[model samples]
Target chain A: MSILDSIRTALRAIAANRLRSGLTALGLVIGVASVIVLIAVGQGAQQGVQERIRGLGSDLIFVKPAAQTDRSTGARGAQGGGITLTAADADAITEAKIPGVVGIAPQLSFNAQAIAQSQNLGVTIIGTTPSYADVRDARVAQGAFIGADDIDRRSLTIVLGSAVAASLFPDGDAIGQQVRIALGPQGFNFRVLGVMEPRGGTGEQDNYAFIPVSSLSARFQFLRNPRGDISVNQINIRTAPGAKQEPIETAITDVLAQRHQVVTPDFTVQSQNDLVGAAAEVSRTLSILLGSIAGISLIVGGIGTMNIMLVSVTERTREIGIRRAVGARGTDVMRQFVTEAIVLSLVGGLIGTGIGVGVAMGIDGRDISGTAMQTAIQTWSIVLAFGVALLVGLISGSYPAFRAARLDPILALRSE
Target chain B: MIHLENVEKVYRTEAGEVRALDGVSLDVQAGEFIAIMGSSGSGKSTMMNIIGLLDDPTAGTYTLDGADVSKLDDDTRSKLRGRLFGFVFQSYNLVPRMTAVEQVELPLLYQRGTNRRAMALEALDRVGLADRASHQPNQLSGGQQQRVAIARSLVVHPNVILADEPTGALDTRTSEEVMGIFGNLAREQRITVVVVTHESNIADFTNRTVRMRDGLIISDERRLQVIPSSASSPDASIPVSEVGS
Candidate 1:
């Protein structure tokens, strides 16, 4: 039979039994829809993580002090005490002769409480050089960030996080206002200079304040040795644009290794590329896992299709016999039944795709706190799901179609 | 022309094998109107089903138009059935929801590349049912449904029409009208008509009658004269006296 005739016959048969066909197609619809929605969510999460990583400059490298080797256990940082980096290390890096080296900053962090108009808020305070903002890719929304003059003069000026500024000064100006910083036994007053833009807030780095390194060292003398020995907590390095990050990272690692004498590769050296790559790997695995789970539904839907097709074959035995007696070949009967099954599954798949996309979009539009869950519907996933549905239809419908084709016309006609 | 040479059909059941048609042989010439008469359980229906290609013989050879039909495959048999023969059943077997024209057009659908509507109308006109072309089977009388079945059988222009008790459900008056249509088809179209019936009076309408008993042909005879119509009967003048009794 021609394709048009097969379609007409399939449509007529389906129309003759509308309720059964609809129920059978429902399984496939749900399966395909879930696959699309779940994968979309997974894709959205993956893209969000990638974007966050990219927002932190891809060539930015973070170097932390290596754990100290114990004299007894020979294990590095066995009890959480490690070798400390110093300001001299930062100077060595600034003075290092290396191409693609743009800017470097030494950092020290402390937890402190600040009092403004009898309202006290506990916040993390970061002490760094004036170049910290440039290396970290941080932008100031109001007023100006810390300048070299503040560091030189040892000025008591601070930059506020967006959240901290909003909390301390609800309706008034935060810049040029005095805020009292209370430590163990001493309290110093500092003026707010600027407010940082809102980066991602779920991390410890986003809810901190920035202050001049010289002022922090001078005020908190207990945190350093009396001989002016400063212990640097971390070093942030930014590479030149369009420069290969691996070579620059290796060059920095060599410099740090020579200065710290850490020949065992113990120090932790990480870049934005490494973090993004790890996140992408995790996202890919998650996508596959979700896809497989949804694929189970498709299999169940396929089984439903097969079961219904077998029932249809039995129900239409007389009709099959009549058509065969009228000159329909076994191949033609097989094609007709299989066509009906595929049509049902394909229609279900399309409906499911539409529903899945709509649901994903709805979720993306909602207000979720903290970690933003983003969903992007990929074209490849839709095509893959549709193709799988067609395959399921073909595989599920084959057995029943073949059975219908092989029926003995004489015996079938004799069937009441 | 059709010939059956010692055709044997045995059906296996839970009790035992039942020989439906045991070594039955017969010959039928073209344009001959014949009736196979038998009582119940005489294998007459089995013979009709085999002749209609609805079943196959277990053994022996059957030929139609000198071609061996017993050896043909299911597809070839279906093609032969469409081209060489048409069937009518005792129940009229007009699709219940179909109109008379659609009922008659059914058989022609099996014949490849035929102008179905024209042939259906021509056949309906031949059976004198053209006026009721749009009437459903239930709307028509028993005789009219039988006439529609006859028209369905004739629409394909088959060389032979096999009808199993075509007038079995009709009254005596309606049966005669249905028999008149068959007689006209056989006479005007020169098509062979074979019928199976238990009613001896119905057999009188055919040109030849073959009687069967215990799955075998017992007697075969040809009627030399056609029966006259009831309008011309001598009882037509005296019908008023019999109506009171």
Candidate 2:
């Protein structure tokens, strides 16, 4: 006498109940696929942050006013620490000619409405030297950037960011056009100098306008300090390629501290590498959150699998008895039932993988929520998801399989 | 050959203990065709189950081919049952949606053998069901379904065939047809055959009849055979003690 292998018997049994089996596997398919898709999105957000940071320019140090924690008057102390760095401080750092300092650019910034033709949009107005373009990697894609003569003459010339250019001048001929930079009803007109090259990602860099600091002081007289110095927002220092940011940052800080004549400097210095590290830490946390939520769905899918298996056992009670009558042992019956369950989950896992991969590929470069969506598919995620599916099959299927094996042959044989 | 020594079977229920079989002892040599006759609740089916090794006697020793099988483990007993006995039931007990050959392949499916399909076909041929090998139980007549079940029993080449109410579901003609197959199996294959039934006419087909009542064997009678075979000198009457405690 010869019997088909346990797996074959299980396949036949599953085939016999095609609708039920298919429905049972549907839960697993959705669970696994959602896991892959959601993780891809989360990882994509992380990748987006890392890419934006890398695009922020390398070997650079940022000097900004420190947020002071004053127990006496906390909120007003924050206002006091604001705008401590000025254009004169930037001039001091540059004139010092500290070794390895490639370029120096200080910025005075404000959010205002920029209007051209019939179009007007809220944009960040950045007042800085022509060196701001070089130190910040803001390449000119059109005619030219703000010239040194523009800073000396305090000319009302503007270099539009990629997004601002596209918005203010749909004709793409903004090199000689006039755009109105306004603070409410009071406004000033500036000539368009050039459009900066397009930077990917929906970041502030691509939505800003650059102008001369002298022009900023000329237009807004109230912004000048008592010493007639132009107060700047932040200073960006670019170092030579492959140069360390620490020594360059210390030199710039010392120069500024001497210029300000303060014992404890009222500024904080941060490197680009520091920001990148913080972004990575954030991504790790996001991945864990995404992974656990998906895992719960998979467990729910496993419970669905167990439910059907138990029902199948009860439905086939007489079949079990018939097998026993024909000399099948308890283990043999258990093996057959367990094989069916594993087949269900593994098959579901395989299909889920295919669908997940296909979906991740399909939406990689899609634009969702005004930003390009990027997906990074990790191979380990696929392997781990499939492994968990196999485990779920074994755990959930165990009780039902043992129950089938332990059925009383006499009673089972008598069941209709 | 099969032996049961003073077997007693008790079933525990919520109400009380019910003794299905009380001090019943019986023996049959190889290749004997015997019938167990009794009314409902007379324990004929219980005796068949014990003899077929599908169940154990509550308080007795059941020896099969000189082995004390009462103490055998479940797996070991299952293997012995597959190797030693072929079972047929009144309902045919064929797995649904399976063809005749597939049903015949059931018993052999538990054993390790080759040419399973050919062997199944051969068993079908024994029951004159070779032409119906691919027909499912639902597609066949009641008599044909029973024949297919008989073929399933024969596929494993078992030494003994124990049938419980094998023809209870059949018409008179089909009953005769099914019993004829059992008789031929006993005579031609030299297999020991036992059938449990309540009908006296059904018992007439067997060479010996064991009449049971109230969980006791009332009489054991041997019929005079037209074609004499076996040890003709047999016990005329086997006494069974009263069932009461």
Lowest lDDT 10-residue stretch of candidate 2 chain B: B236-245
Tens-digit per-residue lDDT, A1-416, candidate 2: 22346777778778888999998888788778767876887788788888888888887888888766667766545533577888888888889999999899999888999999999989999999999988998899998999999999999999999999999888778899999998855689999999989887656688989999889888876667777788888888898998877788888888888877888888877888888889989987998898889889889999999999999999899888878888988888888888889999988899888888888878899987886778888787888888888888878888999999999877778788
DockQ of 1: 0.26
What are the per-candidate TM-scores when only chain A is compared?
0.88, 0.89
Q: Which candidate is the best by TM-score?
A: 2
Regions of candidate 2 where Cα sits further than 4 Å from its true position: A1-4, A67-81, A89-101, A240-267, A367-372, B226-245
Give the alpha carbon lDDT tens digit for every residue of B37-150 in model 1.
Answer: 999878887787778776789998888888888877766776777666767767776654568997777655545565678888988998888999999888998888888888
Instruction: Give the per-residue lDDT of model 1 (tens digit) for A47-97.
Output: 877887886665787777766787798765632145366677778878896
Total backbone collisions for each predicted model:
0, 1
Highest-scoring model, lDDT: 2
lDDT of each: 0.79, 0.84
**Candidate 2 residue A86 C-alpha distance from true site, Å:** 2.6
